[model samples]
Each structure stands twice: as C-alpha cells, then as structure tokens.
Target: MSKRCFLIEASNQEATEGQIMTVVQSSASHPLYGDIVTIVGKNRVNDNPVIISAYSKDSCHLEAERPGIVVMPNSVEEVQKIVRLCSSTKTPIMPAGGRNGICGACLPRVTNAVMLDMINMNGIVNLDEDVMTITVEAGMRWAELIHRLDDKGYKLGFRGPYGGNAATVAGSVSINSMGYAASRFGPAPEGVVSLEVVLPNGEIVRTGSGWNPEAQIFTRYSSFADLTGIFLGDHGTLGVKTKVTFKIYPKAEFSTYIDLGYKNLKDATAAFLEIQKRGLTEELNCLLARESADTYFPGLLDSHPEINATIHCVIMETDKQLAERKVQIIRDIGLDLKGKDLGNFAAQIHWAEKFNEVQPMYNNGFWLNTCHLRPISRIPELMDRMRAIFKKYSLEKNGIKWIADALAVDRAYAAAWVTIFAPTKDKMELAEKAWNEMLDAAMETGGCPYWSGLLWEKRALEKVNDTFIQLYRTIKKSIDP
Candidate 1:
C-alpha cells in the first residue's frame, strides 16, 4: 500500500542552519509496516510525519524518541497479534492512551518502537449494576465513563484525574493519578477492581477476581497475590491494559463546598490534615502559599489580606445531614486553627470546572510541574524549602511564576503539584534549573513521585533504595525481557 510521505524542514534545539529532517518514511521501506497494517488495516496504521510528530511529545515539556510508526488496534485480538509480531521481530512496542500525561510516560523511548494508539479500542464492555462495577476498555476516556455512570445514578470513587476530560481510565490508573475525589477515595488505582492486560509475550491475563472463570470482576484482592497492583502505576511497562473494571458507587445526593483561609501555611496544613483524617471531604485541595492562592484564584486574596494560605473542601454524602455535619466538623477545625471563612466561591468554581481549570493556566506560562506525594504534616517545611529555592533562582525577578498546590489523597498524604512557570521560551533554562532543584528538595523532604517518566526517572533511580531498585529491575526483566 502507498501512503503520503511529507518531508519538512524544521528548526529544533539540535538543528543547524538549513537542515532537513525526515520524520516519516514510506511504509514500503519498513519491514514490519505491512505486517502491522495487515493486523489492524491500513486506515488504522500510519507512518506519516504528521501523525508521528503529534505522538512525539505529551503534555510535558520534554520530547523523547519518536516511534517509527503508529497503529490503532480496535480489538484485543488485534492487539495480541501486533504484540506477537513485534515480540518475534525483536521490536519495541509502546502503548499510548489519551496522551494527556504531564510526564513523558506515553512517549516512545526507542525510535524503532511501534506506538500502539489505544484510543480506537475505547468501548464500554460491561456495567454490572448488580455487582456495582463498571468494566470499560482501557482506552476509554474518564470523562465519558463518568458521564455514562452519571446517567445511571452511579459514580466512581475517585471520579478521574484533573485531566479527566482527555485522560483515559487505564492511563490515569496506570500512573496512579490522584485528583477529583481523591480526598476520600485515594488515587485512581484504588478504585480499580480488575484489569485485562496483554503481556509482552502476547499472552492475555486477567487479574483480581476475574481469574476465577466462574466469578465476575468484583474485588482486587482476591485469590492468589494481588496481581492487579503489579500493573497499576507500572507506566505500561509490565503489560498493555486492554480492559479495566472499576468499583462504582451510587451518586451522592448531597455535597457542600467550603473554602477556608489561614494566616499561615502551618494553620492551613493543620486544618487540611484534620479534615482529611476525619474523612470529611469528597475532594480537598490546598494552596499553601499566598502566591499560589493568587495564581489560582487571581484577586480573591485582596479582600482577605490576613489570609496567607487557602484550603478548598468539597464534602459529599448520601444524606444532606451527613454532608452538612461533616462540613460543620471541618469548619470547626478550621476555626480552631485560626482560619477565616472564605466562602465557597473558589471551591465551587473548581468543582464546576474540574477538568478545565488547570489547562487554561498554561496561558500564563510553560509549567515545569513537580508532581509528587508528600506527607501533610511536612507540607509547611516543604513550602519553606521551595520558597528558598525560588528565591535563590530569583524566579520573580526573572518573570517566572510559581505555585505550590496540594490535593489531599487518601487520609494522611497529599499529591502536590509544585509548578514553576516560564512565561517565555527564553526563561525555560532558568525554569528547568529551578525545577530540578525543587525536585531534589521534594525528595529530601520525603516526597515520592507517582509517575517516573522521562522527567523523574533519573532522580528517582538515584534516590530509590538499592534493594528496591534491584527487585523492580528483576521483576521488569522477568516480565518484559
């Protein structure tokens, strides 16, 4: 089959004057191109420059090795066939979904890799109301899944990531994303009950209760070892998840949004931890600095000059009284911590535009996001250190902005997105230097990143325990090697 090959001249960081780049090659030249096209059809496979360039980078600032070809498989059988062919040919295969990851997790690490664009495989497989579970194809976007469940008066524990509008169910769970309702439901992986993964050898395996031929996907910790955990947050290293089953909950009828302002980070973080420990929020997030609050809410802090930090709480319950009671308890905690009631404008706006709030902020600058997990109690210390680093980098003088925002996860920890903004291309180098320093500071403060893409892999390897690294390497080699 013949396909259009466009040759373009572009300037890159490594480009010299008058350099030509060949991003795409004719399918006739690729040895495995015909084989992949045969499995998924020509319409579903492309080696065109336009398609390859689009998949070269994700939401992150870094771009890695681009795949030689991209293919969209519509069925599990097609995925298996493609994987088998790649495995036999000793070719690298990378699974990509949604392409909404802030880390470079979806980018191919090798040039010869086959990019399995899983978006086409997106489909709802089952919704077992009796079992209170929803099974969907791995490529299904979270926003669509949530909307479908909403129509049925049901919802997921952790609804989805902040990028839910474009983030896929498997994509968020694969990276253990914490967002939306994570204050009570924890990260995305906690809600997953089962997974249908295609291993590197092209063999299909079912995890959780699905292992039992007679049982449905009801629970994650059933039968032998918790195999489901192996692939959760594996960054698609262990296998390609083709299907996902998530535990569903009846839609909560009542919800209350509250925003509390504290004079200092210590008070704000204390109140946040108290509310989380009491399990009083469906969604909870905090801006631990006045700068962060200003960045997020703009001029709201002008009225409350005494407030240096702000906490936004979203409480949901089956009963209105229960939700109110939880809100009252949170209010009392905030009051005791010397927090001022800021009303629910911030919280309401955030909830109303959950999937959109963060994206639009990109207009402000290029974000060097240092997203990681850290203890709630240590947030004050972390902020102090972060401020020091920012000051050292003269970020404000350089016209670079920053925000330290945290989402309360589970009950005790927080998923912090310490973002550094580079408003112009000229400031990227300084922003990167500040970002790397902040990353080291976060690690020193006992923070752990959920996803180690091209951004955090090197730092994580350097800081991770030797024994843990060996064990992980052994597991990876055994599974994919």
Candidate 2:
C-alpha cells in the first residue's frame, strides 16, 4: 500500500515536537503514574507498532493525527489514572480496541490528542449463569468470547460482524453493529445488559440493573432511568467502556442456509422484507449486487443466470424440521417474485468459511460502503435513488459494487451499498461523489447511514429533527466539559 499522510490539524505546526513530548514528561512527573501505567513520549510512542496499529494502522484506511503522547494502562485503575492525567492536562483522549474497525470514528481528528490503548485491560470479569449474563472487560475479542461461551454450553445473542474476531466487544457495542445474527437476536446493543463506563472526568459508573445495589448483571432498564442507551452507540464519545455485561442464549440446535437470485434489486429487497415479516430467517447475511457476486463469489456468480441480485439466508431453530420449513418459505417467496433458487449449496459452502470471509467482499482492495437502515417499505425507494446515483456517476463501469443486508423485517433493516475500486485519482473522485449522493439520499428518505458519529450523524439528525444536533452537541459538551 502506498503511504500517504493527511495532517488533520495545525496543532503540529503551532507546537513543536519537543513541546509535545513535554506533555508526557510532565505526566510521569505526577505521582499517580504507577507500575501498572506507562507513559511514552512521541519518540517512543511513534516507534511502537502495537500502539500505532491501534491508531490508524489497520483497516480503517484514514490517517489520524499522531498523538503527542500514548499511555498504556493494564487495569481499570490505571485507565482512570491515565484519563485523569489527560483531563488535568486538558488533552483530548481517543480510545481504541483491537484496531480492526474500518469506520474512521475512532481516529483522532486533532493533533496533540492522547490515545487510550485498552488492549491490555482484556479479562473476563465474571460469568453469572444464574443471571444469564457474562461480564467481560472492554478489550476482549469476540472470537475468544464465542468459543469460551460454547465451551461452557452457552452462546451469545448475536454474532460479531464479519470482522468480529478482530473487533472488540466494546468497539462493536459502541457502534451498535448489525451482523449475521441481527435477524435472530437483534442489533449488538440489544444484547448489552450493562456497561461499566469511565466518565470523561475519570469516574467509573455502572449502568443497567447493576446500577442498583443488587449487583446482578442480568437485565437492562432497571427500575430507575436507563442511561445505558446513551453509550450504546456513542462511539466512545461520552466515556471509555471499562467492563460490559451481555445477555446470552443457548446454542441453536439446527442451522441451515439457502440462496436465491433475483432479476432486480427491488424484488430481492421485497422478498427479504417478506421473509423478515414472517420471521422465517435467523440471518439474511448477503444481498449481493451482480458485480458484488462476481467480485466476492465468482463461482456462484458464474452458475447464476445473469441475475441482478442474490440473497443469502441463514435459518436456525431447535428442531431441524422447523428450520427447513422456514427455508422453504423463503424459497417460495423468491420464486413467486420470479426469482431463481440458486440452491443452498453455495450458501452452505460460504457458511463453512464465513469466519474468515472479510476479504472477499472488500473488493480485493479499497472501497467505501454506505450502510442505510430503514423500514422494508422504503428500501425500494432507496434502491431507486441509490441506483440513480451510481448511474449518474457511471460507478457501475468503474468497479463499484453495491451490497445490502436484511437487518430485520421487524425493525429498520440495513441496505448497504459498497463501491469497490482501485485508488486511482479519477476513480477515487468518482467514488467520493457516489458515496456522498448515496448517503444524502439515505438520510433524506428517513434512513440512517452507518458510522453515524463520523459520516452521517449531522445530516441524518437534521433530517429527523434539526434540534437533535444541538441537543447532542449540548450533551457532548456537558459530559466532556
């Protein structure tokens, strides 16, 4: 990959490197810098790949202003202490976990910021089967958690996103990711029972039912006011997640797959909504455009009859018969709409290798994805607008491909459109134009785009209720001030 840097701020020009390093040297001057916490100046911090990797080194592909100082803290106490030091110095803090997110929200927007590297704080705090919840430190990985739960005869309510193994629990919850298990259990935030949040001022507060003295981490929406929702998708703006508790479920007795092809995008989305309305599928993981199918699953794409779209369904139930019945319903719906049964053979094969399937859809390289979530009734409208944007920009011929997921028929399902292309100057410009138009249409039509904090928050909120932006700004200031 070509290495290019876009300095996000002028703080570097205003303050010299020596002046920046002074912040760290000054922090170690405090007596609170204990054995569990280590402070590194710009020289040492920039040299360490692990810390830098968490900043802008992974999949997000955006350049972050290099922090003047980096702090490594292994425990919550150390985390609080580090936060206080940054607070006292009035340095902006950006928190990170696993370093695998493609969304640029975690990157620092300004220079001289301090990064809260939470990797070392990973530890399973408790597993209360009696309460039917498990508590883990914020830095724990989803891949490990899944295996751990299964080892003890339990399962999570949701699957991590395709990159779940590389994404942290706190990270995914912060984004409220809609993943493979969304149709079955709900969004990532739905499974979160409580949060142990380190406030901007370094105070640790517990939310959920645990807010009271009972200490049982099972339920959300305690008798008191629920503050947990405030942080569910905040992207770590309000505070740092120290610990979290999530609801769990029994392992499904049966899991099955089915694939269907549609002649048009509109019909595929309609079929998906109907399937979702009937609650027949546990997961509608893939809604691939023709180009998407070609790029991601060439073999399957070759077998299909030049269909414009394809949908992948994952059905699960305790009884094998019931699972098969739901899949049949999906097939019937698809066929009724003049759809083709591509057969479950390809879907089954995809499921077998789904754990490591992130790269196939990534366009073999760089791409931008627009995640739009709205009710099923509006998907066709959104599709028309999205297609127009692509046509206007001639994105179809430029290697751009669109993909959507049936987030839920019962809720606002997501319709994600991705454009894959090499980073050539002309293609990059066109890609930008297409992305902006797609997102604008999404919010204009009562849909919310993904990565709200960074990409679509202002526009989406303004379209819904203009006052919300101000209210959120006020809340942000109130919490961080």
User: Model 2 clash pairs?
Assistant: none
Task: Give me the displacement of residue 386 in model 2, in angstroms.
Answer: 3.1
lDDT of 2 by residue, 366-396 (tens): 6566665677667667767877887898776
The residue-by-residue lDDT of candidate 1 on 1-481, one tens digit each, is: 1122111121111222111123454454456889986786566677776778888988877889988888877778888999999999999898999888988998888777898888766677777776788888888888888888889789999988889898999899999888999999999999999999999999999999988887767788865999999999999988899999999999998989899999889988988998899888999999988988888898878999899999999988999899898888888898988989888889988888889888888987987988999999999889888999999999999999888899999889999988988999999998899998998988999999988899789988887798998999999999989
TM-score of each: 0.93, 0.84
The CA lDDT of each predicted structure is 0.86, 0.69
**Which runs in model 2 stand beyond 4 Å of their true positions?**
1-54, 286-288, 301-303, 361-363, 396-412, 423-426, 461-466
Runs with alpha carbons beyond 4 Å of true place in candidate 1: 1-27
Candidate that would win on TM-score: 1
**Model 2 TM-score (2 dp):** 0.84
lDDT of 1 at 95: 91
